[model samples]
Target: MSALAPAVPRRTPLDSFAGTWHLTRFMLRRDRVRLTVWTVSLLALYAYFVTALSALYPAAEDRQGRAALMEQPASIFLGGPNYGLDDYTIGAMFANEMTLWMIGLLGVMNMFEVVRNTRAEEESGRAEMVRSGAVGRHAAVAASLLTVVFANVVFALLGSALLITAGGLAVADTFALSTAIAVTGLVFAAVALVTSQLTTHGRGATGLGLAVLGFAVLVRGIGDLQAEPGEHGTWLSWLSPIAWAQQMRAYVDLRWWPLALSVVAILVLLALGAFLASKRDFDGALLTGGSGRAEAPSMLSNPLAMSWRQQRIALFWWFLGTFVMFGATGTYLGEGVEDMVDDIAGSNPEAAKMFGDDPLTGFLAIMILYAALAAAGYAIATTLRAKNEEADGRLDITLAKPVSRGRWFAAHLAVVAFGAFVLTMISGALALWAGALVNGEVELATFLKGGAAFLPAVAVFMALTAALYAWVPKITPVVWALFAFTAITGMFGPLFDLPDAVAGISPIWWVGRYPQEPIEPSHMIGLSVVAAVLLVAAFVGFRRRDITS
Candidate 1:
């Protein structure tokens, strides 16, 4: 009896990682469609860019000229740092044209994926149910990270293979380039994991991660824009994970040390997230930011008003980014519009045509298109809120009251449509004012015309999203797919040599290139008609469909 002493529990490295593999499989099963679609689509897009570039710039001089133009300030701001721009190969052009944008896109995808699997599940109460079993505290986070890493690896292998074999890129350059892209995505994935631990709401977690991304892009742009040609040091690009990918200089020097910096950052973030997860309760957030208002306001009594209240924060961020980032673009172009326009025209004939006579107005036109896309994104997210609410069993309570399906749905659609209109105007006005201030002239008419040009396109997307929400609620995510298809085709169609028939499917294509070309009143009228039809159909469908929880 005396010899029977206290026993210590034995733990191994695997103990901390217990259930990670099973959880990973479960997450994969849950998100298979999403994961597969994202991976294949991204890889195909990357491959298309590489393949198209080789055909577009078959001549060596053509490649060199395009590469030099990429070194311009506007290019660096629009596309991240263009490494190896002097190299006479498609790989270098691909690095310049696609790397930064791809990094940003992949960062966003990683953020949403990590947050959806971790914080979103926890918020929805599914995570607690899973954790109640034999799952370890760290398993969910670990599984999410590992799954993302695996996806990135798959993307790198497929993307690099395409570049090497199809595009005839040097093996070393392709390897380095692909690794840089993968590592950039991993950094954001880790950031999302840390954010998921800190924020109670999944949207907050996403916003925190994207805010970091925005800050990094801004720092890298400012740093590179100011640094002298072939200059280094004292620039914030050295500190941005996105910039670190370009600093690797895939085709030129194949510098790999910057990746070590990313590795260090990722490890530190993962460790911090694990520690925080262990310290907090199962469903608790480390940063709750206190409670909301004790009672609902009178304004919130209306479904339309409530929708606005729910979406105001997201709209605020979009408006801020559009105002600052797009406005900064205008400011940069204003310093020497003629030179910038000529440089851009020399590189891209389609852009030259789109910009037309007044370079400022032309630039504003391009910004308007981007702003319209952002507005569409806001609308899509807002429309999808119905799905979220329904899944959370909140929609039933509202429906059980006096709320008619049509009225409730119409209220959401109205809010989304109205918000997009306001945000687009705000973005356009700010960009116009900034550009005017720099050029020593202000033209309110130009701002109004340019900003209003894309509203029809934005409305079409909003209406499309509403239709999806009404008729095919289960496949509402496909609206994003449609949006992506249009965005990719519209943005890269010329470069990729895609047929007009294929590119014409996007509503963006219908928004005739403005300022350079006259606005098409007939086309705008048609878009408006289409939007109205979609909304009417959506309302009818919503009334007849079963509202599921």
Candidate 2:
């Protein structure tokens, strides 16, 4: 006690990280429901697709035949690169089908930080307290990365187990398939991790991540297309991280090194992000936050404008999805339904009328169906804004003002309308652009024509979402559930011999199968009537509701 004690160091790793364990526990608690849902949903999708692939391409010859048929520009863009489709290569089928779509969706979902460290923390001011503790600059970042890594590991293990349990495929193929999907998930996890670091806000993080995700898809698609023509586009695909992860092909021609690339890239990004945090002041960003307006802008003067401002980014994504689907990847991929019609016509030519040869009508119908689905995504997202407002407490204070309940409802409706309108154009436009790009055909009318066809069908999703939000406010996530069911069914249902009753349940089914070009007057009539009825009901029901806990 008499001896002078050595001067204590100003900081230690444990002091700075003491709250990390607590933060990890908190992150787990918040994300359990979300993690469960994401894992289960992915499992269901995995099972359905594995079954579909096993059945549809049972032999090496079948795989080759399918690959040959995938030559259509729409098919190339949407279904992705198929490596000759050998039975051993069934893993590639899953890779081509699920990798980009799942990764992009999951990447965006994980990056939003809607659960832990960002928006939710901001909403509750939990972040301020956590920082006030002995936490270091990198604790939050480390905690968030740890959470995402845990989620990806869980997802991988769960997926591997389900693929094994799902049965039918060869054991080797099953492992390969699961590995490919897991790698895809891991790639997205890395992407989302880096994205969360760069933005000051959750939405911004999501936007940055999705933009990368979208670019990954486009790069892969373009690279694949170029490679087929014996060009350097294959080099382009090689440049993309997604293409690298996918080339592993688990069961066939496995390239293990790409996983290393993802790991290295993710680690480097994490280090950079952590280093930035160490240098910056606490609660600060490497990039400065933009100054908020001194007074509210005139554009945000109304409830509708406020709604639009909040969701404009979401609208942009929906628009992109719609247009891309329409052009070549999405709506155009729907064109693949026509590929089997030759076999169908040979067996029963009558079935070919809607599902028939002469791909023009079938292709158009596919385009419309895609257009509707893309539009629905936007509609559901736009309608969900109401829930977000109330949950965030924005609605409570706004309603306390002179704004009438009806005006408040009406303002959000206006955003839905504008977003929905742009969404329609986007669906048509992206499809047109992709198709034109690959085909080297850029006539203005042709582009306009391609984009124009999807407008009416997409309007239906907006109306349907509005209806759901109106009738049931608390259960807002139901729209996503509905979309999931419809999407899974639309994708693999036909291959599994799904019952008409099951298929009919999706409003997307009523929009008519597209790229088949079966645009019946009755289909348009049905779509319009359904949209009108739902919208009227939503407005009516919303008008009668009161606020709740």
Candidate 3:
């Protein structure tokens, strides 16, 4: 019988996804708190925007005036194409003004979630351990993708429900916008999956994913700017998934066709990611790094220098990102400042009171606050790097050398401090430069002072993160929760008519909205003192504790 043909195994198409559902459940359990926080924060943001808009523009004329203000080049560049501007309703305004921003935020969340589960797991060696069990070759990637998809769906459903109930928005329109947001998030998750296959490290995968996101934003912005006022963007916008979400045009002649583009892109990317995964070996990457030098660099001789070397790439990306975003925003300050301020002041007295008299200064103060928030984010991430090192057993190895625990911890803190200050200053300088190019009246010194004024507040957050990492390493993530609380309070307290005692809880609030309101010395000194105390606590705690890893 032809030597009894060797029994050949029959492979089903779904064989590669054998343990996908099991792994997906495991991921859900692992990321329960993280997913909950993300979902809640996004929903709260949507609610805040809707509430603020309702209060800011009670009449059709107010909404129309806001739309006219948004017609300027800078607004269009930052916002969406000028859809529904002719007779802009509140729903239409939400669709045009908020959709792109929400999409961008969701895209970041999805990309990080995907990379954290897939590439980060592999880098930490846990993925190999899991695969050695009953898991199939593509089970981990499938599980990550599934988990992210579930999160997006939950966000879409809850967000749509909130809009319909809270804002009394049309059911159809709310669903359309929420669906766009969810689908856009899926596209980025797929992009991250493909990127994870390309790079061996989690950070590399995340950077590649963010680079694609940035490119999409740029293309969409250019396309929108190239279009005539009060019209849809040119075909270039059609190439971007972001633009696809925006072009759904919820509440403004809603079109469902654009979402088809997003769905197709997601499918293509997911397939490519799977094919690449099949081609690569476990714990391997399609894009390999170059060989290392024979000798160590001089910069590796000291702990501080080594910390700087590890963090420089992230710092560069932060600077570049802030430069482009703030510069674009600065360009809008020139001619549109007066009309924009007037619209806010005329419709919403609370907003007017917050902005103060000088429109330019008031606007710059708000922008600087945003810049400070970004700097604080950088600080928190840098601070957490120290904890990651300890958890990965690197700290134990380094400590075995002549390096002291306090010194090693302090080295990371120094990098965080330097990076925060540099990022704040760069943001302030670029905004002034870009505004001057258009307005010609922006005072560089005033903007710089505005940036500097927030440094103490930024330091407070960095120090808080360090303290958390030192004492309660397991709860270090609470710093992000604290950040979210502060962000909501500081950004929306005035609009919400929150009590002074409650608003004062945010460190940023104590700074008194610089340039709009004069910076108080007492507040700055208090914040500095708090930061110093926290740093001392971090050093003491870190020195006393045993290295866990």
Which of the numbered candidates is closest to the native, going by highest lDDT? 3
Clashes of each: 0, 24, 0
Error of 3 at 412 (Å): 0.8
lDDT of 2 by residue, 1-549 (tens): 599989987876666556677777788788788777877787777777666666655666556545555656656665556553434356666666666666665565566543246534643567878778776655666676677667767766767766666644446655654554455555555565555556566566667777877888888787887765533247778767676656665555665666676667667766665565566554444566678778888777677777777778787787776666566643333334445535433443222333446544443444444555666677777777787777777788888887887788777877777776666555554555455455344334433443344444456666667767777765666778878877766544444456888887776666445434334667667778877787788778877876643
Worst lDDT 10-window in candidate 2: 344-353
Tens digits of per-residue lDDT for model 3, 14-66? 88888999999999999999899888989998988887778777777777767
Taken over the whole model, the C-alpha lDDT of each candidate is: 0.78, 0.62, 0.85
Q: Indicate the residue-level lDDT of 260 in model 3.
A: 92
* Whole-structure CA lDDT of model 3: 0.85
User: TM-score ranking from best to worst?
Assistant: 3, 1, 2
Q: Write the per-residue lDDT of candidate 1 for residues 32-141, one digit (tens) a residue.
A: 88888888988888887777676657766667756665665657775566666656577767876688778888888888899999999999899899888888878898
Q: If both were scored by TM-score, which would come out higher, candidate 1 or candidate 3?
A: 3
Error in Å for residue 523 of model 3: 1.9
Scored by TM-score, the top model is 3
As for model 3, its CA RMSD to the true structure in angstroms is 2.1
How does model 2 score by TM-score?
A: 0.82
